[model samples]
Target: MNFIKSLDDKVWMTAKARYNASARLNKKHQALTFTISFLSVAQIVLTFCMLVDICFGFPEKVLMFIAMTTSVMILVIANQSALGSLLIESEKLHRFGIKFQSLYEEISLYIKLDKANKSVEEGFQQRYSQLLREADINHLKIDEELVKAERKSFELNPICALWIKFKNLVAIYLSSFLYLAIPLGLLWGASWLK
Candidate 1:
């Protein structure tokens, strides 16, 4: 009886551990997703501010330059974060966690209700084998999803089509440098007009 109880405990522990890992991975990817989105929006706003500063000079040209440089940094970070998030496949991780939780519940119930014919240890092994098969399938699907996601580029909103075009035409770092220079060049040109 004690050995059977220990085996049951082991199955629960294993499932819980897997569920926790998946949940943690999902959270990390979710955070990266949020960060990338925030940075992208910030980059767009900064670009707009730079354009306005070019047309109508700001009170502090130095601050405007700083803002442009900062936007470039933000863009770089956003791209990298997006790439990382895509690699992690957060959605798949989240789905797997939920599914694993369901499996754990089912196994627990099975242990409780269906203990008539087989020994407790045998029943535990049967449920555990099913869990392992499901887990294997989940991992394969996630790997495929990750592959597809990694192949995709960092997509932006419709409003960011211009940035997408720019990215396609120029390398990211070079493009970021050009973005940094645009506001400064425009400011310099504006100053010359004065």
Candidate 2:
């Protein structure tokens, strides 16, 4: 009875520990997502402002040059943030995968032990059966939960990919817009000089 109870207690403890670890990983993932999102927004805003300045001729040649430089800086920052978020999320997933593998191995050992002692005392038999059932159920539940988590993590991947692509596109588009704006600005300024 005591042995059965100890086994049950250990199973519960392991499940609880895995649950807590997964929750912490999820929170970290959320923080990283938020950071990437915020940086993207800031980058978009800066790009828009720089485009507007180029279109309106607000600060002459010097102002346009400054605007272009600032936009490039924002693009660099956004790219770095996006890359960092991807790497961290991948690390979290790897850790969770390891935990799952370890849990599976431990459960398999317990199952094997239970099978080997099939001719034990009736009380031992009953306790073994009960422990096996509980362990199997708990493992299934954890696996299902992990599946949901993996799905969510997969969803975030494409979003991050799109964001990176969008940032690159914006950078290219704005750079070209500024390239054209520079010569046009010079021509307009030359006319003013005349």
Candidate 3:
């Protein structure tokens, strides 16, 4: 028998996939929240040092002006990044992940009980949709892709898998790091000249 022929099976499958995706998304958000936050703090500290240098007449006039401007830009960008991915949003995503987990379990139970009727399926589907609406924001596409990957593990050729992993690495980790690293490197190099 095609397992998914039953409505409850379909609902349970979708809910389980969604829950897994949400969990991955939550992890991504938490990582972004922590990484961006740490980088912002480091930027602020670097900016403070630049200000100190300005006060002490440690840099040439032109360099001092550049440093001051750079400091302001750093502060502005840090504020923007913080606003873009607030800790509260990450916490909200975490809560949503739990909610998805609950929904998944509920559907599984319904399936186990052989209560796979149209009404039950529709109700659970509506609940899923409502939960998504309440979330107010959806998981990133990468999260969905990762969940699909888990379900279809080793199906892709080695080259394809490597490409996907590389893309994920760059998107999830390297991009954020480079955003801060480039500016920090410039500031650090500027410091060395002082």
Candidate 4:
């Protein structure tokens, strides 16, 4: 009974860790996607502005030149940032997190049922093997040093982490409004207002 309890505790902890890692990775993936989209849109908008200036004799040639150059640089950086399996790995981590959660729940159920007719070792081995296969399929290569550094930097302070996340959300929304929504609204000002 004690051994089963210990095993269950270990599995639960592992599952919780997986879920936390998944959330972190997914957040990174989302941030990268947003950054990529923002850079792409900025590039298009700046190009359009440049063309308009070329045709209409609108001033601000120097300013537009600077903006275009900056946009190009941003686009390049964003593209480079995406030159990885981040999205695929994030999705796989999410699936693995769910799997861990499910396994945890099953173990909890087994424990509550007094372990009758339930082979904890067998169940754990099966689920753990599945997780291994998933890791292989997803090519999940975790850098322990980086992970440890990140955890030490971010996860140590819950309040700060929450605040940072809130800030990121606000930045994403504000940038979206500024870069996409406002321009779109201006483009269809009359129709949209009506």
Candidate 5:
């Protein structure tokens, strides 16, 4: 009886952990949509600016070149990665996460009601596995770092936290650097207009 009780508890605990992980991954995948939109728009604008002769100096051209190159590279990577189907798959990741959320809720209700039903317990386990297989997408290390930061779980070492924070900052601001400098250069060049 004790062994069986422990097994049941383990299943429930595992489900909760999986839910937590998937929820975080879903959020990260959603960020992919923003990332796509941001880089795509920035690239289009920069490319258009280049076409419109926004070149203020060699520096502006260099900035534009760097921005567009990063955009193209990301597009290629998106297509080649599990991030395939780009926005659509990213959306799917969110949808699957919703399913996981539902499953977690169901597990909670069952636990509150009666956890001794082995058949029901097996069904829950199977459903949990199925959800995972259907989702079929994995989160990245950055996603893990983001989740850890969000949860403030106190498991992350200080050095590791700082490392991930630096990486996150770079990722969040990289696109800005790509497109922002052109304006600065143009502003400085505008002085020549004076």
Candidate 6:
């Protein structure tokens, strides 16, 4: 009875550990998403400010240029970080799925062993069978759900790839705009000063 109790406790503990790890991963994902969104917003705001400064002959044109350049760099970095995190998360999930498959195989082997031991206590056999059946059903359901999730992830992969490419292009364009504006602003300022 103690042995069965210990096994049950161990199983529950393992499940709890996995749950915690998954929760932590989810939190990290959310954080990355928030960070990327914030950076994009900041970039847009800074770009607009730079344009306004250029139009109004704002005295702090150099500062505006610096702000715009900095924002663009930050946005690019944030986008790349988000993409890297997503790739890491996908790999982790794939590895976890494989681990679950191994766990299922091990449990199935235990069930088979119990079945072959006819001399085992009747109550123990019955309980073992019930637990095995429940675990099997749960495992199948989780596998099916994971498959669906993986399919969705694959579907989104191309979209994300395109988005990353778009971000890089935008970053390059913004950088060039800032670079060109500096010399133009300097010439304009010089003429105005004269």
Candidate 4, superposed: residue stretches over 4 Å from native: 52-65, 68-78, 115-119, 122-134, 137-194
lDDT of 4 by residue, 1-194 (tens): 66556666655555555554555556665665675577567657656777666523334554355455546545554565452565666566667667766877777787788844446567675776677576643312232222333455335466655555555455334433443443334334434333
lDDT of 2 by residue, 1-194 (tens): 45544554444444443454444444434554554455445445645766666434344554445445445544654564454553455455445445445554555566557653434434443644554454422322333333333444435466555564454344324433443344346545655654
Best-matching candidate per TM-score: 3
Which of 1 and 6 is the better model by TM-score? 1
Whole-model lDDT, model 5: 0.57
After TM-score superposition, the amount by which residue 63's alpha carbon in candidate 4 deviates from its true location, in angstroms, is 3.7
TM-score of candidate 4 versus the correct structure, residues matched by position: 0.51
Residue-level lDDT of model 6, residues 35-101, one tens digit each, is 4455556556656766666434444555455456555545654665464664465445444544444
For each candidate in the order shown, give its overall lDDT on alpha carbons: 0.51, 0.47, 0.58, 0.54, 0.57, 0.47
Q: Please list all clashing residue pairs in model 4, or write none if there are none.
A: none
State each model's C-alpha RMSD to the native. Answer: 14.7, 14.2, 5.3, 9.6, 6.9, 14.0
In order of listing, the candidates' clash counts read 0, 0, 0, 0, 0, 0
Give one digit per residue, the lDDT tens place, for model 1 in 1-194: 45545555555455444443454445444544555455456557656766666535444555456556556656665675464653455444445556555655655675577564456457556766675666532333333223233333434354455544443234223433444456557556657756
lDDT of 3 by residue, 30-82 (tens): 55565557665654654576666643434555344544554555565467556
TM-score of each: 0.43, 0.32, 0.60, 0.51, 0.49, 0.38
Show model 3 residue runs off by greater than 4 Å: 1-66, 152-154, 184-194
Which candidate, 1 or 4, would have the higher TM-score against the true structure?
Answer: 4
Candidate closer to the true structure by lDDT (higher is better), 1 or 5: 5
Clashing pairs in 5: none
After superposing all C-alphas onto the true structure, candidate 6 shows an RMSD in angstroms of: 14.0
